[model samples]
Target: MTRQDISELYRGYIDCLNRQAWPELGRFVHQEAQYNGQRIGLSGYREMLENDFRAIPDLRFVIDLLIADPPHIAARLCFDCTPVGELFGLPVNGKRVSFTENVFYEIRDGRIAQVFSVIDKEAVRAQLGNDSP
Candidate 1:
């Protein structure tokens, strides 16, 4: 697929996530997708997202940046929400925080086959009144 097509596909995937469209997720994600270094298939991946939404009711993914290179896509997703309890092992406890997650995805057969994500835990910690290490 062309870069534009891949980027469009990714945007649709993000939209699906934002809408919590679990049934339509298979259109964008491979059934045997892997996240980080773990091979957590589609069901596990969906469960993870569901848990995230449960923890942060206002959770929404805003794309701050997106770059597509054929089979690879790099994205910076911005989040501004309050978690019910803790986030990233920090006691957020409904305190509003803003952070960015840098993520990379590998596409195969027009679907996301793998993902590597890094959240800005330090940013969240500082926002929650913790000292930067």
Candidate 2:
């Protein structure tokens, strides 16, 4: 896929997530997808996303930055939401917090085959006033 093609595809994938269109996730995520290093297939991927939405009902993925390099995509996804309980093991407890996730994706056959993601947990911690360390 061309750089533009991959970027558009990624944007579409983000749109699908924002819509919470679980059924359409297969179009963007490979059946044998891997998250971080674990091989969490499409079903597991969907479940993870579902759990995220359940925790933060207002969760929305906003792309603050995006770079498409053929089969690879690097993105900075920003989030501003309130979590009902713990988020990344931090007690957000319905408090609004803003953070960014730096994620890299490897697209295979136009579907996401692998994902390496790191969320800004320290940002959440600071927001929650738990900055010990």
Best by TM-score: 2
- Residue-level lDDT tens digits of model 2 in 1-133: 9999999999999999999999999999999999999999999999999999999999999999999997999999999999999999988899999999999999998999999999999999999999875
Q: Which one wins on lDDT? A: 2
The residue-by-residue lDDT of candidate 1 on 1-133, one tens digit each, is: 8999999999999999999999998999999999998999889999999999999999999999999999999999999998999888898999999999999999999999999999999999888779856
Which regions of candidate 1 fall more than 4 Å away from where they truly are? none
Q: CA lDDT, every prediction?
A: 0.94, 0.96
Q: Alpha carbon lDDT of residue 125, candidate 2? A: 96
For residue 4, model 1's alpha carbon misses the true position, in angstroms, by 1.0
Worst 10 residues of 2 by lDDT: 124-133
Provide the TM-score for each candidate, comma-separated: 0.97, 0.98
